[model samples]
Target: MTAPGTDAPSTSAQDDVLFTGVVVYSTQDPEASAVLVSGGMVAWIGPTETAEGLHPGARRIDATGCLLTPGFVDCLPTADGAAVDDAWRASAASRGITGAVPGSAGIREGMRVLSPVAEPLPLKDLSAQGVPLAFGSLGAEDALDPWSWVRAAAHGGDPAQRISDRAAFLASTRAGLRLLDVPHPGALNLGVEATLVVWEPWDFTVHSSDIRTNAWSVDPRSRTPMLPDLTEGAPRALRTLVRGEIVHDVPGALG
Candidate 1:
């Protein structure tokens, strides 16, 4: 993978890559620790030991102390009339955003709201009512950092109206993709396009709107995927991959 802010070296579709010793966040296999990408798609995902037996010649990426998850998708409008370009894409990739749908029109079946909402609308209630709510950035530049919207929605507004951090995260990722009617909205799974982001390790906690349910939610049996502890601030992206191709990487991140 190339370093951040530089164009990624061209890679063949047949190239194979094995990422080991990383925490993989996937709905299909929450406990997975390794992923093998082949032909620009997810070939296999499971325990690191199992991955060792597959794709013997695949390039290896020792991603210990990292969290691998689906990249964020941004639904944003132009920034001060500036169109989305390579620089903007690089900036977004650096922040763990892999795909974007420019402009705010034609987004039905789900609600897309700007963050730091000036008016507190019963967001949690709307979600509970099956509104399929999602968040967008106020400006194109701010859109790059998906956590900004997550933080604003999860922690802002009246306590009763605030959504849980997990809910906010879903709105920023899968929910946005669902709004666009993309097949298999979220990117993590076997045989899906390997659009992913590896983030610096950070603390995580299971958050819920109800204090009574918080304890049970953290139980291992729940198989819940913990998200970054927003109170400690958002984790930085160490690398970003689009369809298994390295689009951005922080220098020495894997070393």
Candidate 2:
């Protein structure tokens, strides 16, 4: 879980970073103005002034005009013969994935590609390495089929059905895998490791009305793009953190 030129923020008093002027999508609340990270956890969250006052010595990450949300957690199963390498990690980082399942992959020679099978995933070991592990089909593109089906059923249809579909997708993204019996997965809760992603939408404004009435628009800033927009690509991942360590910070991506 290490990246070149990126080290975990220290636990010392001077290591704190007051991340201010961004919309924080914490699990505790759907939104916050700021988040203070210390020792790889969210120490506090509030207005910019309060966060600055509480940690005067902390470095400031001015997140003005940005939208921050929990990092994407991908539970990818390793190809039995292909060792996980820097390329994969780099690719994941590019997609706003800071933490993943099976942090390390095994190596075997003479195979071009390997298929995923229904084997017991190393959830505990990966979690130990700070991977936000989950069960189910991370390796399959159709893993989101169920979500899509429900969403389609809700489209221009019953309001109750839309709400149910939306709730299900949110749970699937956040904590449903654990409910289905995956062990030791990460979550965006206070006191947990600081593994989160910040996104900046290209053209869309994540409106307050949409969050309440539109089931399809769950956190429009999310890089995953809960709502499929054929006209525009999903939001950009401005920053990604694993255990409060900056894994990806795209310069000039957000302004």
Global lDDT of each candidate: 0.74, 0.48
Clashes of 1: 0
- Candidate 2 lDDT over 25-78, as tens digits, reads 544643566778778877877677677777898888777756665554444455
lDDT computed for candidate 2 = 0.48
Off by over 4 Å in 2: 5-14, 77-83, 102-187, 201-231, 252-255
Which residue pairs collide in model 1, if any? none
lDDT of 1 by residue, 60-168 (tens): 8888868888888776665333656787788888999876655653335556454444335678888888776666564545445788777777877688888877778
Candidate 1 segments exceeding 4 Å error: 1-13, 78-82, 105-107, 116-119, 140-144, 185-187
User: How does candidate 1 fare on TM-score?
Assistant: 0.87
How many pairs in model 2 have backbone atoms within 3 A of each other, for residues 3 or more apart or on separate chains, i.e. clashes?
2
Best by lDDT: 1
